[model samples]
Target chain A: MALEAEVWSDIKPIPLDDGPDPLAPIAYDAEYSEAMGYFRAISQRDERSERALKLTERIVEYNPAHYTIWHYRQQILFSLNKNLNEELDFVKEQIESNPKNYQLWHHRQVLVEKLMDASCELPFINEILNDDAKNYHAWTYRQWIIRTFNLWENELDFVNKLLDKDVRNNSAWNQRYFTLFFNPTKPTEEFLTQEIEYVIEKIKMAPNNISPWNYIKGIIAKSNKDIGILEELCKEIEKQDIISPHAIGCLVDIYESRARKGSATDKEEGIRICTLLAEKHDAIRKKYWEYRKVILTSL
Target chain B: MPTEKEFVRDKHISYLKRGLTLLPKQYASNDTNRMTLAFFCLSGLDLLGALESEIPEERRKTWIDWIYAQQILPDERNPEINEKICGFRGSPFSGLPFDPNGSRESRLPFDAANLAMTYTALTSLLILGDDLSRVNRSSIINSLKYLQKDDGSFTQTYQGMESDMRFLYCAVVISYILNDFSGINIEKAIDYIKNSQSYDFGIGQGPGEESHGGSTYCAISSLYMLNKLDEGLLSKEKTLFWLISRQESGFQGRANKPPDTCYSFWIGASLKILDKLELINYEQNHNFLMQTQAKFGGFAKLIDNYPDVMHTYLGIAGLSLMNEPRFLELDPAINISKKAKENLLNNCAFHKQK
Candidate 1:
């Protein structure tokens, strides 16, 4: 992928120096080394020409994780006043190949910010999420786009769709919270109650799923509501013979909070749940449950 | 039924030695991060107690020289222009000429230092038993000021890289090793770390990001190095509970995520740093790590997954934290052998003053 020999004839490529003794030297492909050598020379000269842009594209194709090359490519795109729409298209292709690359996401952000248009971001990120629901970079970038462009109106619906598809999608649950609470208006008491109800329904669908449980806890904490609200629901679930570890874990937290607030009855309840978790339900974290029991007993 | 496996000490040593000599073609994309790769091998060997017996003294000296060569020393002519760019590049990928003696006249335009690379390079030098007399401490400290964003998070470099909890950890580690806090705005940084605490009570890469074991380690370790672990966390008990809950036979980066071998160190080391290492179910954790141990030489991310250098190092470090007698003791906060940390304390000039 090195530049045509005659195109950069005037420049001498700068070879990489690995000092006297290089450790763990990667046997790079010949194409990569040649392109990098010329790239080093072009970058040294601070070139912002079309040739430099082409060189960057070649290097980026080889390694999309190169932040320096992406930075330089952005500068070239700006200095040359190249068609940014075309650049966006190029970035879209790169992102499709390297969905987890932070550099590609950052490059896309720079391009979108400069274009002053976030219209294409949501659908594009949705497509990426459809492939891998928990792509962290895609979710974070989607959040940034939403916050920056005031695209919060449909975010909850998008999160709902994702949750309907996969109830265990923690990223989607986090987004639901972000869309509701991180927006401009503060969440009202009615809205908090509705969110708690929504999470409780999701929890009933899958009692062991921790995402909804965490979501309900977050909603309660945000409203400064008491954890006691979930006590009756836990008891009802247990009455139905559903022995969910997450439900029990939540009960332990609820009781632990009340116990710490000087409720002796809640302390005993917390110790009982901790024992149940240690002996029967969740033996994997037996030590953690035992530790919880010790704290409760001490209280 | 699965049979428990013994720690493959010899195989791991061979795996690390192979990485130190020549990496496979798949690592070509990691050419820019050669320093980090080298750190994984050298530090892994150090933890395995093979540094003295496996690598000769002369070879170690050469490595020390090579790491010193990566240092981005300030341009004496225009110190102000080069001030914020002083630290270590990951490699000579920027095409700087070989200058093991560091007598270069001018700094190149693209030869900027990265915070992660600087942290790894400094630790590598220490692991190789160098005195670090040649490190440009002031320049690096000055660069940290530039790297820190207004939000108190740090970018990897001054050239506008992605800022996150990982880079924040690197910045803190660099300052901790240099024995200077002037470069960091402690209050703002602590605020940033505090804000990164997710509702699950685990720390994330940034505010509103999902709680992850790796970022949790970085965030907690940064707070520990800053002398604010107890005060900095939103809720110590909840955070510890979240961390302990990650151990579903083995550790997962996040809830509902499949168990990965590396989180054994990420979460396990975080627990160790919090002085709650004993809380982990050691036998279960050991059994999980045994499942991930590759038959050849390294540990994989999951059972039957391919072995790689990073996981190999972390898996062994996780065992070391559990007080596994076969491996050297690790300083969980720094992710290096306790012996190497002792070397830093006794010999490095920064500690000499203390």
Candidate 2:
């Protein structure tokens, strides 16, 4: 009689999966009773620690595409917090199963970031960027982390990597230029010269972006003590966007800085270059006068 | 180039109106708030040339009565600050019986002179063509006296928040508009403003805060009002140069913020106040303002955006400064009615002996 009762208790009102018809597929009322009994048994058992996970897994088997159940299963595992490696594995599996889901991808990233810990965070972010070259979120997150850590070398490397993928990425290009301006470490002339050359190469490919032109002007103004790169960048800028006030102002700045530094050759060249640019670019005339005022007063 | 006077007037009138709303009677702040909003909105209308036939006399009288009711008496019993002057509160939140004295049995912490409210209150009275004969002048001065700090900055209320150049400028404008300097310590306030100027020549909110366009205008405008527009505080040339440098086709408030609708009145007005607005490219700034105008006849935060009242007014003010065709003429100083300003001047001369 006990064996018969146990068999009756096991009979679910709703089919769990494809097993046997089992008495013409128990009625919905009986199915509800059996599900309730199963839930009660799991709750009563002291060692059924993974019971929720199992339930979620079974539900997924019936509906493989149920993201909600998959979410619940992940949450239960995470809340238990007993097994991090297992948690990571599960996240990775979800990503593998649903690679197109940006949310899942972000969750995988969070797990990866956690697993790497603080000391290895930057390198891990770079590794992810290396895998997916067009990951804007990853790139931005890496930049933010680098900023907090003040990791100048890592930031420069990140800029180089981004440029290698697409030099015309305006945000990346702008960041590269801003790094020169805002970096805690002062840039040496040699470093800036090399940077100007690299950007010039990119500008050759895409001439419409006014950012590189503006940056080249800043470099010339700051380092007009060395006339070589400044002269080249100035000539290149004149051909690109002569109407950009920022570009023209930079020309004025270079001339004024050179005159102040007593670089006679650069000063003469600066005035001539600025005058020519100012003639063509009406917007920058005020900047020319400002620079002229400074130079005249200094003289 | 749009004149700074035109820019400030148009923008001030326009944005001031945009910020106004006739809250349904159920949502209305109270009789006092109704007065305050009336002052702001009506004053805004008066400045905007849209005031005729709309402001009813009885409604104006009610606002005046409610505003006058917020005045405090000068006596030692009420140890609370701002106890002796007439100023406006933001709203009647505590529902405590309206005490003009700012001292009542159940008065909450909110009972005091709010800087924005006081400015609006005085201006509104003037806009209604009131001679300000009923304003408790002595108590108002005493209230302002308590509102100022040793650092020369004023708080919005006696209950302090951040001490700022904005409030200090407001105090100066209030004093200037009222033709009364009995309330503020001019030297300390000027010193605070001078200290707040960043290396970039733009004024910040306070020491160590980032330079902003709005504060820059406030500092300069206040200095002009105080008759302290000399080389001793902010060198005229350097401040003007900084003001001129803010124009990047459209005006921006700080080092890196993209140009927006508001800064044109701010920096643009400062340059105008300094008589140096001609240094900027008027056509470009005007073009930028015109482009940002909304399709529905309002202005937005930026070009190709939805229009709101604040930006709409600011955009119009910016254009007005340039003396844009079809825009009304404006007073560069104080940015109120040239008609009202003339009236104010006439009143001042009438009372010159005092």
Candidate 3:
């Protein structure tokens, strides 16, 4: 017996230790079974009719990931000319109930796309991210909102606010980079300069945080800027405290870049630092540093 | 966190086995992830060294048949059209034809195969001792071409959905399991993996994304399976350093992220493939994972939480990597029992000879 409705009882939260919860608290096991049996019988018919749609709605209320229910609901929506705004409200509740379900996210996407507007999406994403800043589904859906709706104008500010709340939120950093990368005007040299300064300031505030350091490195590598900035930054960080692995790693990148341009002095220093890194600080990657040694010497 | 240190293998086995027959209420939301749930049980039991005895004889046959029934074979009647979308859907949620031998031409709109399910379904079949002779390898390989984007990352399907490391890993797995890489653009795929390496040396979903333990595993495991682990990798020491540091009582997927049950497998398996599994603090990880075990059975995302299928399977896999007693050896690269991997390899060789 699954879910039935021969009698009424107080609805209660199902036990955490189990699965396939009843749609609602029922009077008897037979009642739970009867209701679920009714839902399944109607579902198997797979009709696009009103009764079928209502059955799916009830079943999906219990299990949103029963994606066939969502499919039929969508079909029934179009057929019945249901109020989409009301449907949107219904999806919001489902998403809140089970935010991790992939079907709920996809269904929302279809609804938003059909509406041809993303005004509520930014706020919706903002609300969801507020629940869990690094929720991958929320972030992916946010990205989709930006891409489909051309909402890039506010992305930089969005990322900045999130970063301010938690500097270590790497998802926000990635969003910052994505926002910059996809800017319609194309990130210019001046913009890159500003971007690099923004990242360096963040790095100076928290040198141990790797994401911002990587953001600066990305900006530098993309801009083909003089590696001297990293050298200066590394020196400044050394002044603050013993250099971090990220700083040393950036120095290695700079020297390797220099060595690639055939600076014999830089090449020797690269091999020497790599040897130090191999032997000491970054010993976890000893093999890689050793490989770098062989490559630098051969060069 | 727990008073006892003994691994509750029996409780976990019961939890997974019970799930197969009657899913608990907590998992009602994951109705579509039923295939993944099955993978957890089959693989979990295999890891426990209890698969053969725990699964009833009738169930083994029925599970294999049910999985095959989910496969997306090309329509015999409209080969030209259905050929383009051949793979396995995640579940019977599509309400399509369920035939191991029935016509593949259901003409259902959402009858296409899902990449994650395809990966899990094949692995589950192998765990169940299915020879995979009935798996439509050619159609799946052919369907992979449609999933790949111009940049070499793959979407979950051909419907222009989100593409990232998850599907990239799936595509690589499907290719490697079938012993054919022709459908994938190896060089481009390698480029995508390389680009995904963030400043911290961990891999992410795509270029410029945040590094995550799961994506790092996918990226590393994909490259290893493709024979390009070293060549495509960047910042090796940084990546290794980052991975080794993830172990703070089990493992976390990223910096500042709390240790979770699944990362123990994702990061541990990555370290194993990198030949640095020995670097982790075994006692600490063991204690952490033990803390996450549910009283009734199974492992949760973190200590003192409800257990779920994904985390429980991975928790066992992670412990297996540590060679936890009574658990079977895990072939870390593909997250299967070493015995299952041998079967797959032998199967591949047998097919090659033909």
- DockQ each: 0.75, 0.02, 0.18
DockQ order, best first, reads: 1, 3, 2
User: lDDT of model 2 at residue A210?
Assistant: 43
- Model 1, A163-214: lDDT tens digits are 9999999888888878887899777888888888988999999998888888
Q: Is the docking of candidate 1 incorrect, acceptable, medium or high quality?
A: medium
Task: Estimate the TM-score for candidate 1.
Answer: 0.98
Residue pairs with clashing backbones, model 1: none
Q: Kindly list the per-residue Cα lDDT of model 3 for residues A148-235, writing each as its tens digit.
A: 7888987888899999999988788878877887556578788888888888888887887877876676667667877668898887
lDDT of 3: 0.76
TM-score of chain B of each: 0.98, 0.80, 0.96
User: Model 2, B102-125: lDDT tens per residue?
Assistant: 433323323455666677666665
Name the runs in model 2 displaced over 4 angstroms.
A1-279, A282-299, B1-40, B56-58, B70-86, B96-109, B232-235, B304-306, B325-327, B348-351
Error of 3 at A283 (Å): 9.9
Give DockQ: model 2.
Answer: 0.02
- Model 3 CA deviation exceeding 4 Å by range: A1-46, A79-83, A226-228, A231-299, B1-6, B53-59, B72-113, B142-163, B181-201, B206-208, B228-245, B274-284, B323-326, B348-352
Residue A76 in model 3: shift from native, Å? Answer: 3.2
